[model samples]
Target: MAHFSYRGRSAAGKEVKGEIEANNLDLAVEALMRQGVIPLKVSAKKQASGLNVDVSSLLNRPIALEPLVIFCRQMYSLTKAGVPLLRAIRGLSQSTTHKLLAQTLDKVHYDLTNGRNFSSALRSHPRVFSELFVSMIAVGESTGRLEEALLQLANYFEQEMETRRRIKSAMRYPIFVLSAIFIALVVLNLKVIPQFSSMFSKFGMDLPLPTKILIGMSNFFVNYWYWMIASMIAFALGMRMWIGTTTGRERWDLWRLKVPIVGDIVNRAQLSRFSRSFSLMLKAGVPLNQSIQLSAEALGNRFLENRLIGMKTAIEAGSSMTVTASNSGVFTPLVQQMIAVGEETGQIDELLLEVADFYDREVDYDLKTLTARIEPILLAIVAGMVLLLALGIFLPMWDMLDIARGA
Candidate 1:
């Protein structure tokens, strides 16, 4: 099917324009008419191609989490307040300032009004709504708890955003300091170091080993800067492509879990997310097996996803939750014990939620300490590099001065 952009009027004489998918313009018009939209004009969506057009450049946009969380909360509120689904979507679509989100919501609303269920409509836009999102909403619709489910979804996304913020904050200082050091080195290599080299040559003084080494480095950097930058970019892109593959993703995630300081935080954060999502699904009355399946899918870590699959298999074979988790080797001993107790107490969902909360706090504290530790280390590294360069340059000049005094 091809997508068509259409201009139309509603039954109440309101002008509306949007995009719809159909076999042809005629079919698109018919679809619009079915939705009480009197189509005045319809045309196939145009494909743009020009010298200035660069489709891949658009891939650099950052994923904004705030708008998505707000959307979930607002949609949940509107639905809870008895607003018809289509009307609520239309209102949200009109109110949204983001073109991409507005277009998505418009299409979703149109689909919903045309007899598609919420989850199916969302499924059509995978770039906007993830598989986990569609699954949760499907469960909600099936159990007649859409409002509650949406609220939980909002909280889930908010927590994810918070986690990302924490990690970014922890890493930001190091990144900034390293970037500054690189810039300073570039300036020194391209400009300052060459002057020192020329002066030393005129003096007919043999430069010390450190000065000689620094000068050689500067020359290489000046000559091969473009190649260096190109290699870095290529490496990054290649790594990203590799990580997009299943086996590569699993290997990378496993490596991340083994990283000294950062790995521990990542592992705990993922566990917290899993615990929270599992608790939410269970509280929503989703069956135990299905909840485990959905929670595993929600984990977003390939290695953990595989472990969850094993746990799912064990459950199918009549193993208890505690035993399945214990066998997985991902859960810590403390977590496993708590889960076992929860199972015995018949309050597994609540206990899992509490565990999630506890881990969330722990993650926050760890991020703070990690940031504190990393800041001083990064600053010290920059300071050490600067001191070395200064010594390399000045020590040669000092030797020349001592020779002059002796002469």
Candidate 2:
């Protein structure tokens, strides 16, 4: 069947726009007329371009989480008020201020009007709606609880935004300090060290080892700055290419979870995501196997995703949740116990939510104390750099002073 897009007037003289599938233009208009819409303009919908890379899509930025949260909340309110799905989408499309979201909603509205389900319509826009989001909607639609699903999604995204905001805020000071250190190092290499080297050369005296090292480093920096920049760019591009590979990406993700100071937070954050997503999916009436699969994919850790996929495999083979979780080796002992108890009581969803809460609290505390934890290490690094600079710049002067006094 061919798809046609149409703009028309409803029975109440309200403007409407949508797509309809039919064998021909005449049939499309006939179908619309059957739905009480007078087709003012009807034409064949443009098929997707055959190009592998869509320039327009490339230029369009992905919608942000805040807008999604707003969209979900609005959908929940509207759906709860008994508004028809298509009309709700159409209204939202018209009312939304975000250009991308409005455009996306317009497409979703068209699909809904064309007799497509909301979840399936959303699935078509993967750049706008995630798998988890679409799955939630599907579950909602199936279970007749779409409003509740939207509410849950809104809450989930709100929490996620808060966590991300806190992390960024906590990291800001460290990032600034590090940037300052880098600038200082550059200034010393380019300006301060060079001047010192020229002055030392005029003395016609032997320099100490530290001074010699400093002069040599300064000379290299001054002479080979372009090479350094080239190497940095090349290394960055190389790393990007390596990380693009499945194996390299997996290994790097695993290494991220083992890094000092940062790893613990990353682990807890990922666990929190998995637990919350798993709980959400299960509570929404999704099947256990599907819930595990979706939650694992949402974790953003390849190592954990692979491990939980194994857990899914084990469970599919008739292993218990607790047994599979324990065998996965990613969950903590406490979490394993909770899963076991949850399994026994048939309250696994609630238990997983509690696990998420526990991890969220842990992450919050760590984020708050993150600067305190990192301060000592940063100070030590700065202190060592300062000491080196002091010694490198001053040691030669001390020797020159002794030589002059002796002469």
**Top candidate by TM-score:** 2
The digit string of per-residue lDDT tens for model 2 on 189-294 reads 9999999999999999888888888889899999999999999999999999998888988998999999898898989988998999899999999889878877
The TM-score that candidate 2 achieves is 0.86
Query: What's the true lDDT of residue 300 in model 1?
Result: 72
* Model 1 residue pairs with clashes: none
- lDDT at position 134, candidate 2: 85
Candidate 2: worst-modelled 10 consecutive residues by lDDT = 49-58
- Residue 196 error, candidate 1, Å: 0.8
Which pairs clash in model 2?
A: none
How many pairs of residues in model 2 come into backbone collision? Answer: 0
Q: List ranges where model 1 is wrong by over 4 Å.
A: 1-63
| C-alpha lDDT (0 to 100) for residue 50 of candidate 2 | 63
CA displacement after TM-score superposition, residue 118 of candidate 1 (Å) = 1.5
RMSD of 2: 9.5
* Model 1, span 1-407: residue lDDT tens: 99888765576544588999998554675688689975545656766745545453365343367878988999999999999989999999999887667888999988888887898677556457765677678889998899998999899889989898998888887788789888888999999999898888899888888898889999899899999999999999999999998799999989988997789899989989989888888887877776776687667788987888788778878899999989999887888988999999999999898888888888899998997777777778878887779888999999999999999
